[model samples]
Target: MSGVPTGSSGDLENKDILSYVALGDSFTEGMSDPYPDSDSVPNGRYRGWADRVAEHLADHVSEVRYANLAVRGRLIAQIRDEQVPRAVEMSPDLITLCAGGNDIIRPGSDPDKVVEIFESMIAELRSTGARVVIFTGFDTNWQPVMRHLRGKIATYNMHMRSVADRYGCDVVDVWSMRILDDQRAWNWDRLHLSSEGHRRLALRVCEVLDLPVDDDWNRPWPPPEPRGWRSARQEDLHWAREFLVPWIGRRLTGRSSGDGVSPKRPELQRCERYRPGD
Candidate 1:
């Protein structure tokens, strides 16, 4: 439950990490955070934590080939059936997997069952001798409706830790990263991390990998602007109408935000670091 320390034995520091692949749901897909230099590009990509980590690795190594096989709204089963095999085939030097968030949040979902499938995916990925990385779901106890699901999330996180231990994998324990308790860390939808949140997570991942970083993941943010009850209620109403309602409707109809959406970067290609005003 403490902050992730630097220079741990689990670090992939000295490995010839020439290639990396990321796998999972919306969290791994990099939602709510648009690429910074995307003003000139229409429908620019969501550069999430995985991409940021890839960019950092690219800087340290010679031509770090990176691929992200994550799609938003994917279930654990979908990831196992769809993305896991492809990642194994690619045989990257490193792999990051963060699935099961969508499943644990769904109605009538069983954490045990979800983690069982997740463990299988981890087992297969480890078989390739790639250094595998996994993530724990964020603590949503402070959020509304989602707060009720925190129990399930915690259950899943516990199992994830045990599995990671058994599989010799690294973990970016999002649940223990208390700096993410701020509202500014979330996007308007409250489902995915904001740009700032993604940046912090990237730093955490780098720390786990024993990669060099210039910023602190635990750095404090500027003071938040205060809002009155009426203003807060109005914003909540707008969020429910614009995001919450549509999300629930899609679930009822068995539709997903990623119904036809493809992975942003499917092939193992060189990654460029994202810079402001580039």
Candidate 2:
């Protein structure tokens, strides 16, 4: 990927500007969210944690450039073979990496192999004169079937922290931020993230990058109250009579209700994070 020049010449006033490169998988690609607009674009092209981190940085810093080369479903080897070279060519001041989810999902994939690839990527990024490298861990809700994968994820995170410590890079603990001891946070699929999850993640990334903190990032945003239980019950019954009854009838008796009922993969609820004074 080519380096996108950022900040005006006037923005640089006797201070060295920092260039950033963000690399990783679907979470890094801002999957499951609409792309943020340009004035909102600062950290990277993708609007995940990286972009949010950039937004926070914009409050305190002026001269910063970023390149995002993350793609959905990319494994460690693919990143090692492809993304690392492009990132190195950019000569970034900081590199943030989020990977290893796909590896955990694939059968017969070894965690040690994933670690090796990540370490190689780190070494290559460090060669680019980047002062600091930030590595992120997988969210606990990566998959419901692979619940045991958490141990592997932990192993990889431990390796990442050790490698970062050895090479003087920073480690962001995203896993802990999203996966608490409680169950209020995960999305419907028990994978991916809820809006609250993303908000918390964005705030933590800002903290790890040493960027200015936003108080709105920490406040709780409650869901809107339903019209009323009676109204909701009526609405539910109407839906059952209007849609569900016909769909079930068609499925059970091989009859055509002409409703075109196709089950869709469960989507995470699109709840917006609470902003101050909203």
**What TM-score would you give candidate 2 relative to the actual structure?**
0.65
**Candidate 2, 61-92: lDDT as tens digits:** 55556566776656678767767787777766
What tens-digit string does per-residue lDDT give for candidate 1 at 1-278?
A: 12222212343445554788999988998887788766732253788899899988877876688999999899999999999999999988889999999899999999999999998898888887788889999999879869999899999999999988877888998999999999889998888899999999999999988899999999998888888999999999999999999999999999999888888888999787767732
Q: What is the lDDT of residue 254 in candidate 2?
A: 51
Weakest lDDT window of 10 consecutive positions for candidate 1 = 1-10
- Evaluate model 1: give its TM-score: 0.93
How much is 116 displaced in model 2, in angstroms? Answer: 1.0
Quote each prediction's TM-score.
0.93, 0.65
Query: Which residue pairs in candidate 2 collide?
Result: none
Q: Which portions of model 1 show Cα errors greater than 4 Å?
A: 1-17, 39-44
RMSD of 2: 11.3
